[model samples]
Target: MAQQAYMTETDNQGSGHEPRGTRIRRLMSRLANRLFAGGRDGRGIWRRGMVLTALAVLVGLIMLLHAQVPNTIGNSGSLIETFLPWLGVSVPVLLVLALVRRSATALIAVLFPAIVWLNLFGGLLGDKAGTGGDLTVATHNVNADNPDPAGTARDVAASGADVVALEELKTSAVPVYEKALASTYRYHSVQGTVGLWSKYPMTGVRAVDIQLGWTRAMRATVTTPEGQVAVYVAHMPSVRVKMEAGFTARQRDKSADALGEAIADEKLTKVVLLGDLNGTMNDRALNGVTSQMRSTQGAAGSGFGFSWPASFPMARIDQILVKGIEPESSWTLPETGSDHLPVAARVSVDTSS
Candidate 1:
């Protein structure tokens, strides 16, 4: 009996008498051994991990340093920036590859690009709908060669937008649009190929020179129930990508500069610019205007809201920009008879503020 008791006591002492720090050290040692344990070729596993880590870091750098890319090559920097959100797709691809390889290093590396992409465009992915605003404004580039002008006009008018701006308004189809919109918009102003139709009274209507030699832009003041808001409509010269000349948008860039100067000189506090800018907001060619105004679509829309080539929209060239007004919501309307879709934004103009 004595020997049995001694043996039990000795076993208990051996199992439970170790110092807490010693036990913790032993546990950590086992974990480390397990984690570091690898296949027969340990170096190959580490090499793979290093490669994935490098790839992940590259992804993050590409997104964060995209602006450093030169625009001289067909304005490629702007083109990339316009589709910056797409870079996030690579993160998931890298993650899947990491899971397939079972590399902890690659998995850890993916966090960098994921965080970088989210930091760049996370806000844009969220739901942006808020309370409706005091005024809803819409814009469309009614293709100059539209097959059905009356149908296009009717579609736009049906939107019931308080203010509508139409660009690329051809001379032959002007009357059709006028007749179609006259009932809803009693106050209208047409300057060259651009026009503004308003539900409220309009004043200070005049053509604004965009250095385009012709009247392709106009500005007006609309006296709505909420307040007087300055409205400017423009159709920037089209840009083209040629094999020899690369991205040829010199004319559009010059026009943008002139438009910026015009807006800067305006005395009004509240302003909205609606038109086919012919360039995305990311394009440096439109930096003059983009710097001075906030894009309604970017501020409140649910998505990129590309409006060009209604059949297969690739970029959002049509824009609704505002200054001294709060955008409540923004969206793109369905395809009409025109080649381009309509874009709209609702803004709150708190005149008292």
Candidate 2:
């Protein structure tokens, strides 16, 4: 009887002197057991990953209601919209986490973002390009500090674009560009930091004001075989993101408004705009310009024709937009010495219309 009493006392002492880690493990095991009850029909589906489920739901709502997000704080709405397509990345990640935790609730919540993302971007995955077009146009932001202006001109000329627009033109490099492209393009004009070269006859070329006090945009009439088209070449003011100021793009936004007004006033029925807009088509600040026009890449390009930062393109800031011209094919040109890769599009202008 004494031996039995001694053994009982030893057992009590061991329980009281258990290590902290051991005690934590025991507590966690009990909690996990309560969370995941064994059952053949997945009885504990609703009891897991409460935090993960909440996060997944929030991500889905953010994607679904992104436009409603206010820009009062640091222009967060524009920033979000600029990279809106990337928001889909969270869906697959959340799904993986849900599967690992056997969380039915989180898995179901993840579907919200998945569906919303597919609805927005699914159409972009297919090849919509046609085989024929009457005119081909291209645009490039030949970096102001490009090392080889002549070679860059030759590269764009090789694309066989009937009309080409170059932005960020340096005063010194204008002659080099003109000389290199002179052989292929007979008509050309340069105004401030932007220029346009065309195989067809060009007239009525003039600098357009975008409220920067100097010319960064221009409009010209190109007489193609089909008819006359008013082409606009613009290099919108660059935008920056700062820790103190957030997305600093008020100037760009103003310029876009002015540019939109200018386009709205054009006399010609067929219009094509090309340039480095410095913002994605999804950015709301550009609504003044985008609302009335259509993107060639969106209409005919096979993929997300991201054309900026040639080394690692993440956005299609360089664009070809149209009011009446129909896009047949769209694509990006090979990398030049400049920072941005040139974008090209083939468009059909019906003669009978």
Candidate 1 wrongly placed segments (more than 4 Å): 1-44, 49-55, 101-103, 351-353
How would you encode candidate 1's per-residue C-alpha lDDT over 167-244 as one tens digit per residue? 999999999999999989999989999999999999999999999899999999999788889999999999887887
Score residue 141 of candidate 1 by CA lDDT.
Answer: 97
Overall local distance difference test of candidate 2: 0.91
Global CA lDDT of candidate 1, please?
0.87
RMSD of 1: 5.7
- Which numbered prediction scores highest in lDDT against the true structure? 2
The clash count for each model shown is 0, 0
For candidate 1, the per-residue lDDT at 276 reads: 96
